[model samples]
Target: MSYLMMFYSAFFSTSVSASETAATANPMRSQVVADLVEFLIEAGQYLGMKLEQGSMSYQLFALGSIFLVAFASFILAKLILHFKVLRLVSRSNNTWDDCLMEAGVFRRIARIVPGIVVYTTYSLFFEPEDKLYSLLANFSAIYLLFTAWRTLSGSLTAIENIYSRSLLAKKAPITGFIQVTKLLLTLVLIFLLLSLLLGKSPIYLLSGLTAIAAVLLLIFRDTILGFVAGIQIAANRMFNTGDWIAMPKYEVDGEILEIGLNVVKVQNWDKTISTLPTYSLTTDAVKNWRGMTESGGRRIKRSVYLDIHSVSFADAELLEEWEGMKLLNQYLKDKKQELVEDRKLKEIEETDILNCRRLTNLGTFRAYLTSYLKKHEMINQDLTCMVRQLKPTEIGIPLEIYCFSKEKNWVAYEQIQADIFDHVLAILPVFKLRAYQRVSSHNEQAQKNAQ
Candidate 1:
């Protein structure tokens, strides 16, 4: 092995000068490699074997030596990466290095070591004009290219992970961009691989690609559309990871798990995963709730239908009873004074309840709800908050509460909403109101028989 090292070093030193010659088109066609093979054959003869230049014995020894050297180089590179590079990365305060480590960028780079070692030293084992030499060269080149691809892909992944931690990532993600770059990298790798395999220039092969451009387009139609959609989504500051988006067209209603080049993954509320094409996000109607999340409020728009038969004007008894309530006392007192003054000015009699400015139970209930919501701890007072009646339907008059909740979390918001409706339904009877309930066939028959 010591002699072998000396041979390699001396071979490289001489090959540098020999490579400058016009006749030396291939650097692997070295006189030093020829000398090394002759030395191996002589050594084999000294061992009392019937050895010759092209003998199986000499070739086996040479091939085994190449494997040993390539394996040693690979192990050395891996050890250096683990002890030196990884140690430094682990100690670094910056998170990006950790991301790179996790992405296996260093590991992928280490895999190139064996290919490089084999490429430089393989000529020593066989004559440059031998078929084995060409085969080894091709294999080494392909191995290098493949390892380079892995390294570059890992680098891109590390880049995306680093960018995801930035504040800008929440506004505009780069995952799609990273994926698009990977796709381009793959295409380039394929072109280079084809050129290498076919023994042609990359540019020559690329020129031929123009003839099959339509087929390529059809094959990569979604990929091409996704790239364009990704650009639009990023530039326009569209939805990002963790955003709750609803694309009914795709039956997707969930928080975005990932946004990639070709697809956007959403984890639906039912815990089912939905995958939508990236282009579909741009072309289809996707409702992004990022605005609500960023605004620190989640809108709540719901209706409580009150049985129309239960609604009536507030009588003197009802007003007096509501005056003792904390939420409605001041409101009732203020309205009473305003109404008394208005009636006196208009010369209207209090006996005429319709003409006189008296409060209805529905109106007073709306005011109470408004005041209650304004003071509720969980509701966002800064945003729109109101309670009003909707047009009476066959079933009932809908009292709609339109407001936003301070809690933006799904579970918390749901709990807050539930709490509000619970309070509304429980307190409705106090206003002499009843929630509309559909009559069952059994109850309808009983009612009809009683009537």
Candidate 2:
């Protein structure tokens, strides 16, 4: 095969010079020259031309040589993959190489063996001047580019998966960044491949991109915005995977499952997924419940209205009754003594109910609520806990309970709130305070029957 390739190279060199001299000496002989060359070539080939004379036999030998080289390279590559490289890669603890193997990066590199053999043997089958050799070389280059692209892309995806599962990734995720890098790499490779196909320098082709920069930006506006937003989100710690966020503008109220370059996926409380543009998080309002979850308690703010007619100064009988109640015994006794002494010192008439500082049922009920919350096991004592009155309305007086529940979980917190309210409602009558309710037909009918 080597001898045939050498002979063909020598013969083509001499024949090209001879044809050039013949054409220059007699221009009209060019057609006759081509025909004579073809006849001699066909006749010599039929006559069983030998390698010793550098004839068409050498061309057949060269063609056979190329096929043999290709076959040998393929077998060698397969053997290397099976017995040598893949096993070694798979045995290592370093998963990057394993990923490469799984993604066929190694296999793609192995293909280079066959490609090199084919390229080196290409000249054996045909002269450099032949159009087929040039076409084959071009096609091979294109195929090589495609193989490299596939290998790189697959390896990137594998790497991304591995990295996304790592400890560092848990604290600071970079999946979006990695994906963007892969996309840019692909674009660069595509541009290089295009330059090779056009027989132009990559720089020359890239220079034209400057002119279309605006158009490119317009086409990829969303992607650009998302990329920027992703950076901002990461740097600011605005949101992360598994964060509960509520965005009313996009109707997304859920935990963020993924943050991508162009979109953020949220798994709603109902288990439905909502896709939101990445930029929207930066530009619009979103409520992140991470703070609440991290806090010691969950806020509880609620109001209970009291009937105005149910409120009155605590008289001796009522005070004595309240004193018997263990929860408010000390408070009632102290207040009653203080009121009596103040009235006597100020020389105010004891019969005048409004003349001195006196405990009202509504005020006592508010105090009871505050004390109850402070002692409640589910309420966080470390945080502010207050039971106070808001401005009275036409229906009644507004008693607002402001406190924090110790439990932060949704269900537990709700249960605690319900229990607290239940106790408060039940004990309201004990304080001689009635929850405001509209007069109904039942009350009117009972009153008429009694009359």
Candidate 3:
């Protein structure tokens, strides 16, 4: 094989000068390959078989040489990169080289080197006008297209992996974008490949494709919608991996598991997996809890209905009982003094509870709630913290506790909220207040027991 390459090089060296002179006198056809085949046929005849030019022996030898050349070139390129270049790249301190390694960037690029060698060297082993030349050329082009596809795919993988480590990835994930790119590339490669195989122009094939437009649309309906939707979702930064989204229509109330081109996977809190169409995310309503998480607080907006009949004015006994409460001492003292001053100046009758100023249990309870929440460590004091009264319902007046919780974790926030309501409900009797309870069969039985 080494001697053949040397002879082959020497023959091409002489043929080039002869071809220049022959071009002026006659046609400079590649007879060098023909002469080489003759020499190989003579060599094969010396091995006891009668050989002839264009016979099975000569054809096998020519094909074998081409295969051997391609295989040898590919092995050499791969070994060099594997032993020296890629090994060194892997050991480098730079983060990008490591990313390339994981994406198989070097391996994909190396695989193309052999196809390129074969593409350029095929003319050397076979005559330019030979039947095999056209076949080899088409095969080489196909190889290049396939290898180029892999190279681009690996490069996209590297880009995605590198970008994912950045801070912006959390706000806007791009995995779906990368997948869409690969899908488009695949469609283009398929078009180019079919055109090459059928010996048709790409524009001709594209024109022919329009005839089947309805079929293609029906087949790729989901894929087309997903591709378009993936672009919008990624570009708009609507949702990302780990973002908690609540889509009631889809029964999805959990964080995103994976965002892909055709599907967006969500792992529900109930441990079930919900697969949503990528386009549906843009079409449907979704509640993104990302704002609450990023804002460092979760809203604790709950109401405890208070029985209107239990509300009463604070008399001497009730006022004394409220005075013993640590949180309401200052408030009660100020109100008492204010009432006394108003009585002395206005000359109003103190016996009339409605006309004159007097504290109500509901008002004192609201004050006590305000003071308790302000001192509570779990409540977000930086935002609105208040005990507001809503309109009276058929049940009772709703005393709503509108505030934000410092603990944002689901379980922790629930425990904190429950602890607050527990204390409030237990001490309501001391303030002559009672929570409204809806009538049930059990509740009617409990009323009978109380009677």
lDDT of 2 by residue, 364-401 (tens): 88777777887798888988899989999987888999
lDDT of 3 by residue, 286-371 (tens): 99998999986789889999988789888899988888999999998899899989988888878876678888999999999989
Q: Which stretches of candidate 2 lie over 4 Å from their true place?
A: 1-127, 166-171, 333-352, 394-396, 437-451
What lDDT does candidate 2 reach at residue 186? 76
Q: Which residue pairs of candidate 1 clash?
A: none
TM-score of each: 0.86, 0.73, 0.84
CA lDDT of every candidate = 0.83, 0.75, 0.82
**All-Cα superposition RMSD per candidate:** 6.2, 9.8, 6.9
Q: Could you give candidate 1's per-residue lDDT for residues 103-134 as a string of tens digits? A: 99989998999988888876667655556666
In model 1, which regions exceed 4 Å deviation? 1-60, 124-126, 352-354, 440-451
Candidate with best TM-score: 1
Give the lowest summed-lDDT range of ten residues in model 2: 7-16
lDDT of candidate 1 at residue 431, scale 0 to 100: 94
Model 3, which residues run further than 4 Å from truth?
Answer: 1-53, 128-132, 439-451
Superposition error at 344 for model 2 (Å): 5.7
In candidate 3, the residue pairs with backbone N, CA or C atoms under 3 Å apart (3 or more residues apart, or in different chains) clash, namely none
Distance (Å) between predicted and true CA of 427, model 3?
A: 1.9
